[model samples]
Target: MSDNKSNLTEYLTPLIPLAPVLSVKSLSFVTSKTKKQQSILGCSNKLQLTSGRAAIAIALEHAGIAKNDEVLVPAYHCESMISPVHWRNATPVFYKININTSINVDNIILNITPKTKAIIVTHYFGFLQELTSIRAVCNEHNIILIEDCAHAFFGSLNNQVVGSIGDYAIASSMKFFPCYDGGILASSTRPLGNVNLKKPTLIFQIKAFFNIIERAIYYKRFGIAGKGINALLKVKEWLWNNIKSVSGEHYTCNSPASSDGGYGLEEDWIHKSTSVASNLIIKQSNTKLIIEKRVENYQKIHEALSGLTTAHPLFTKIENGFVPLVFPLYVDAPEQSFDVLKKQGIPIWRFGEYLDKQITEAFCPNSTALSAHVFQFPCHQELTNQELNWMIITIKKTIK
Candidate 1:
């Protein structure tokens, strides 16, 4: 019996997801009349692209930013955020972020110069960046303000939704919602221009649908059934690889590359529109319920970890109407904790790992520390109380 208990504890559990993908049953109820969909469409001249990077590329092009122009970007960011600037042949100037992950406006102003054309501010981990001062500075300098709301699709500040605040804003719907692929670009002052985007190939659409189905199965099945599903997935991969090798076709089975810098922009996919199935998934989702549940889960974890000495949550309190994308914890040894949680099969992520190596500690010390130390846990609406408790207890045991 003791051996059985040891084995069970060692057995890797599947990841607890941050969002719930759409199930087939939910598809029947999809409609365009939901308040969320209406609000998203009404924001401005909107363009839906294959991914957030694509949206940024389009926004830069439409704004008349040309090669050799400088665009200020927060140092603490994913490579995808920086990749679009390269795609446009624009230079990226890194700015420091404060302890709360908001941009230091002083650093931004210092970085701006005659060649500066735009500034991109990110609402890190869904906490709103205080944008009024930054906007004023941008206005003073005649620099375009672009809000990176990739982590803040539904978040609002002072009653204005994230995408509405900047001269141009972009978001990754896949982060906040269950859609397989989506990117949104919105502007208050100008049209998005006539971007000729072709529909994604049928093969791409089918692959996306299957990916969502696989996530659904992972969420629903357990024990032998779950193991069986995983085994089947492996076999499918093997078969697909063989098919690709024999067919002598370069057809890839996954969604388009999201952040290849500027390498593959000539491909038909760079101008691809969001999938119809993705649109349907978002149209049918309950925006209010999603926000409330995410807040509840985040607060529950925050309260549980408040007094712990081994690790500290980045945000201790949840503000009204703020929906968190993840619960970020700053720990003493991030690499060790990440390995422990990963071994236990907890779905965890660290965006710091994906930061471009070109960004040095000298350029942005605070962002460097955050990149190395902050670990993000799943706090999306999909997690139940029991799962949240497991994650909290696991961290308490491992971090010390």
Candidate 2:
């Protein structure tokens, strides 16, 4: 990264997250759901883990991917998606995506070799896409199809759900629900068989639950409880600092790398089960309301931006039988507008901003252009009208 861009990133980070955090308002939304939530996990064979990348690792392991095997991954991807391939000591061959971010089947076919063991298809931004053609190619080549649904937990196409069409599917529950962390590995065509998982300790479980509420409070999303959480946090910080000072122990936020947390996958936490709190929240989350609110927010943002000259919606309209994770808009001269929007504290992100070193602009023009120009804005269920407008209005002012 250029020194200027690196400095900007360091100084201007998003105060809020891309995912929904637990708040009193979100809790109320959860209780309103009466139906047992429906999702891709209704499949017969499924396992819950600490994070989506862990599910990916388990998927690769179960598929018998090992050292020297080659996996086909999209050129446009987050590190988490690519890390699992490396974790298995496998090489990932990059494939291109369409300008719309859909998989380029031609690239997939051209890159295939006898060493190709698996191909991962991501349902980018919760857009439900039919996998019939891709599945046909996978079958012809005897390649395992791994569906990456990190951005989408619910959706269907042609009577098949998002995760069911592939040999294995992975979902990041925390992104869709107001939970701390959770992920699921599932398959409809094959049995996951049996694998042991170590339960998280009681202390970790307790903190995981409270941390969600704490995050919400920090964002002032907890209404009247926000002040109380802040006050208690101040007192806690004071006591912690004084105690550490007296003991001559330096304070640090550093923790050992675990598969249960952080960006890259850690082998140690691969077998760790999702925290009880995350599972409970996932179970009780208002699936119906989530779909409803997300669709509403997505359409609203699209409508607001439809008239803008500087940017345009990636998908002219939301697809049927699906909900959106975020409102993706393509802005012209992102070099000019992207940082301006970020400096204004917009909860926006470019998924493939920093891809594998092997990936280049010449190698994947669409991915490179996207990483530079496409910005994703949150459209989660928890966003209020005022909050949504703040984002939309700020985007308009800056993008102009």
Candidate 3:
């Protein structure tokens, strides 16, 4: 809930990044400040929050989910998704997903009860799931659909952008944009009541902006700019030590604040709005190149990894409306390669890795299999040619 200053070594970034890392040059693409961007920010009936889980919590509240109500959540999910249901005091009935991780509509139908009031469907890896059947089923049962678009903030299906199709939808802007903190709750079908929020304190706001620059330098992102930041950081360190020696003050966080999204829902920041800096970045930045570059990078991985014996892509084709958040790959043996790939500094993540204990292999076979095998690699707009090539080569080498 505090600053998302993950220690320099978290999987968030390998020696290379697994997601978008901002640099000074990253802002150059923000061509217009005043023009209304055609992205999700342009949508009406949307509320911004500090993180995606916060939006999920709000979606639960606004969907009229009360205590002990059952909300259909995928068996394969991070704690972020599960925690919000707990926060609402509602039971999360873990539904089985199809092999590709789409909702198993029959499972949903089987699981529904009078207490079941809603269903949450994720647009996994930015590939939109075919939701027409799910929508109809929800309508027939009168269950609200909470579309989770954390991996998908852009692109469209049936001529309507994502996050607008469901009765309620939420997105994680930090994944798509260069900013540190942002999430959106949007609905086209229902008018969203305004979520009153107090601005973050000036110091926190400053840190929110600075954390972007610091994270880039932490990952050694820009060629020369990163090095320059490293040099200045050395000077600052020296000055700080000298000052500490003189003032007899040395601060230490035995446990620095961690866990921004996945650990659990933080009620403290749920009411807080996005910082001013991130809101500006979200609104000003153009996404045309961002989308095109993401698609291009995803295409490269699909073409290169299609032939791998040890690993294969989860989605074979980047469908017309698909915009990827990461290259979702299923390696044959995570026990053999997961740690090795991490040690090799491959920018990879497996959202389904630390799934809830209640979700057993016997309970949900596809979720169990997908949880162990499916790994996500960076396919963000900020990926460099070298990083892309290196990750591809490393993954191929490590797995095979």
Candidate 4:
């Protein structure tokens, strides 16, 4: 049992712990300071929700889309992105994404029908989609445009931020910032009138605060004493499991129920505002510094992986003013490579792999290939140079 436990400890690194939570002092400072200037898209009258999916649900409700109305979504997407449409009893039209993860404009136009009420354009992996062309198509067809910037919190294209491009845009603030939970629903033309979201319960807020603290400690100590920390976490997990066996509580400390993705917007939480902790952290964070560090990390990985025989980066260059969420690499044997990384406890993500079968069939061959091949590596602000170097080296070795 001890040997098995030791072996398990080798594969227990926390996934993507870059965004550090703010301290109470920092939160107080942030709240006391003057509000930051708004982007080209005004910042007033924004509605915050429990998660990005909730934001989408509100946007759909605001657009007045009803049952039998269709909303076009990319085939290369997570379940959370499409689930809201289904929850509304509306049909979802899945469009194909090209090799670069951008929507095939032609395919999207082809998929549009008279019943289509709205089109969701996602800026996948923080790379901007060709919004100009898509926007024109939406106008011509009289369809509402909802830009999904969940992966792109603060990036710009042609001097305009992504959220400004669509009629209504939704972003997952928790993805980019060190927040326990947050989602923003903003509009370009009009104010998002009272969403009626309530404040998160005090218990929920307390759990979030402690989760953030645990994440911070894990990240701060990983570089110095990763093995020791991981061992302790394993012991805790074991003790918790034994307790659960005796009490039949089934409680897990690793991932809480609140952290799970929502299939539909709950009436209780859909109107709930972003947690105070999340709002304060976002207000306190240095946007410029976060963008620069992420860009820098992405470039470093790109330089290292370029021209490799076994794998190559999807988007070869980072455009000006773009802040990437991850460094996407297309490996020849993604399954094998992924397994190798998993054993070593390296954090990697593969979107679109677990998509619905109907979506996979409707989309093009490119979507299928991308789903099987692409792996998203960490390029966030918290990673040390040494960690980045180690990741690059491990990826090269794994792919080869």
Whole-model lDDT per candidate:
0.73, 0.80, 0.79, 0.73
Structure candidate 1, residue pairs in collision: none
Tens-place lDDT digits, model 2, residues 1-400: 0102244534454555567877654545455343334467777799988778888999999999999999999998887888889999999999999988899998899999999999999998888767999999999999999999888898777677779888999998877887776889999988876767888777567667667767788677877868887888779769877999899987453211332234667777677788888898777776787888889999999999989888899888887777788888998878888667778778775777777787788898898888878889999988878888999999998888
Give the range where candidate 4 is weakest over 10 consecutive residues by summed lDDT. 1-10
| Index of the highest-TM-score prediction | 2
Better of 1 and 3 by TM-score: 3
Clashes of 3: 0
lDDT of 2 at 55: 89
Over 1-400, each residue of candidate 3 has an lDDT whose tens digit, in order, gives 1111233354433667666777654566565542333345556788877778888888888888889899999998877888889999999998999888778889889999999998999998898877899999999999999989988988777776777668888888888888778888888777777556666667567667767767788776776878887788778769868988999986541110121333666677777788888888777656776787899999999899999997899887898877888888988887898777777777666776777898888999898898888888888888889888998898888888
Which scores better on lDDT, 1 or 3? 3
Candidate 4 residue runs with Cα over 4 Å from true position = 1-11, 15-44, 221-268
Which pairs clash in model 4?
197-271, 197-272, 198-271, 198-272
CA deviation > 4 Å runs, candidate 2: 1-17, 29-38, 229-262
Poorest 10 consecutive residues by lDDT, candidate 1: 1-10
User: lDDT order of candidates, best first?
Assistant: 2, 3, 1, 4
Q: Is candidate 1 or candidate 2 better by lDDT?
A: 2
TM-scores, each model vs. reference: 0.85, 0.89, 0.88, 0.83
RMSD of 1: 6.2
User: What TM-score does candidate 3 get on C-alpha atoms?
Assistant: 0.88
Report how far off residue 392 is in candidate 3 (Å): 1.0
Candidate 1: where are CA atoms >4 Å away? 1-14, 23-34, 37-42, 221-254, 259-268
Q: Which of the two candidates, 1 or 2, achieves a greater TM-score against the reference?
A: 2
